[model samples]
Target: MSQLELRGIRIQLRSQSSPLIELPELTIQQGEIVVLMGPSGSGKSSLLHWLVGDSLPEFDCSGEIRVGGVRVDALPTQARRIGLRMQQPWLFPHLTVRENLQCAQRGTETPAERARQLQACLDAFGIAHLSEQAPDVMSGGQAARVALARAILNQPAVMLLDEPFSSLDTATREEVRAWTFAQLARQGLPTLLVTHDIQDIPEHAQVIYV
Candidate 1:
């Protein structure tokens, strides 16, 4: 329901260090993708952390992060309702794939409604068969898909993906990237993706080199 917004953003590793990434503003419209690329230590991930209200202890930032025109910089990580998927699946080692997705459905929807939504997410990600499987048993591509499904199940207002497809083989990476983009497009979620690989950039995306 909201696009991602960052205004007057400046991030410093230390108070005395120069800003790593400074931006007057950056916006990703609904259903659009923004590819954030930069050299090592240039703070691409730091920008995402800042936007999600979880700046690392080594960093200090000044910015106004808004979703749907409402400031969320002051909100707690969970309160912000921002979705994130990293290079690893990061699913609970103790839970099955279905449980992982169920745990992410923390919204106010009714139980019946939530179940329907969860099933749809599993089906959409093509992981219905893996629902009862443990996360450790899944292949790289399957784990990535599980992560994507969990993120989508959360129904985030905006999402930040940090090399979500990096861990896959070339062919698998391409397939998962296409599937992920398709799902994101279907939901019209404003997403910021960080990657060093140019192939990961979707068509007509806005790229920001930090």
Candidate 2:
């Protein structure tokens, strides 16, 4: 289990002048789900960007992002161990689901072990049958599940969700949202979910309004 804490964080975007966002303090314990809800341009997405060490080139940020007690601001994005799932379900159009999972496998020793890990991840998300399918052939909900499976295959310390459920119909959205949250809980990964829809949140989440 891993913990994530943000202390005295401030982020600013530089154009000619600076636009800033200040956050007092926030903490998310291991295995907890924290939802950040706010309207567009309220700095919700920027907060995630800062945490994941992928703040846009135009932004200037000063803050402390600690994951499992390690200061991550100075670390590279891959070293941050944060998994991000965005609304677009950004899987490669050219890769099969199995290939996508393979891409996220972090330093598994042997080919067989890597295959086993990928299989387990697909099974966990109930999409093992779709492993050979191309991304374009999968349904929206299925693609979302594959995206999340790929994210967790890396065993990230914390998962960042940026309105992942926004693109589906009500029924599909509800199903995928439930599956995504359940997988996060089972993996015991702390999660930060950013969404505009309150209805998509699971009952167990601790919500913070930005």
Candidate 1's residue-wise lDDT over 1-210, tens digit each?
Answer: 588888999988886658898889888889999999877678888777777777588888888888888888899988886898877889998999999999999878999999999898888778999999999888888989899889878879898999888779999999999989998998899999998889999999999897
Best model number under TM-score: 1
Clashes (N, CA, C under 3 Å) per candidate: 0, 0
> Clashes in candidate 1: how many?
0
* Model 2 TM: 0.94
RMSD to true structure for each model, in Å: 1.4, 1.7
Q: How would you encode candidate 2's per-residue C-alpha lDDT over 154-194 as one tens digit per residue?
A: 88999999999999998999888888888888888888999
Q: What is the lDDT of residue 45 in candidate 2?
A: 86
TM-score for each candidate, following the candidate numbering: 0.95, 0.94
At residue 2, candidate 2 shows an lDDT of 95
Cα lDDT, model 2, residue 185:
84
State each model's CA lDDT, in order: 0.87, 0.86
Which pairs of residues collide in model 2? none
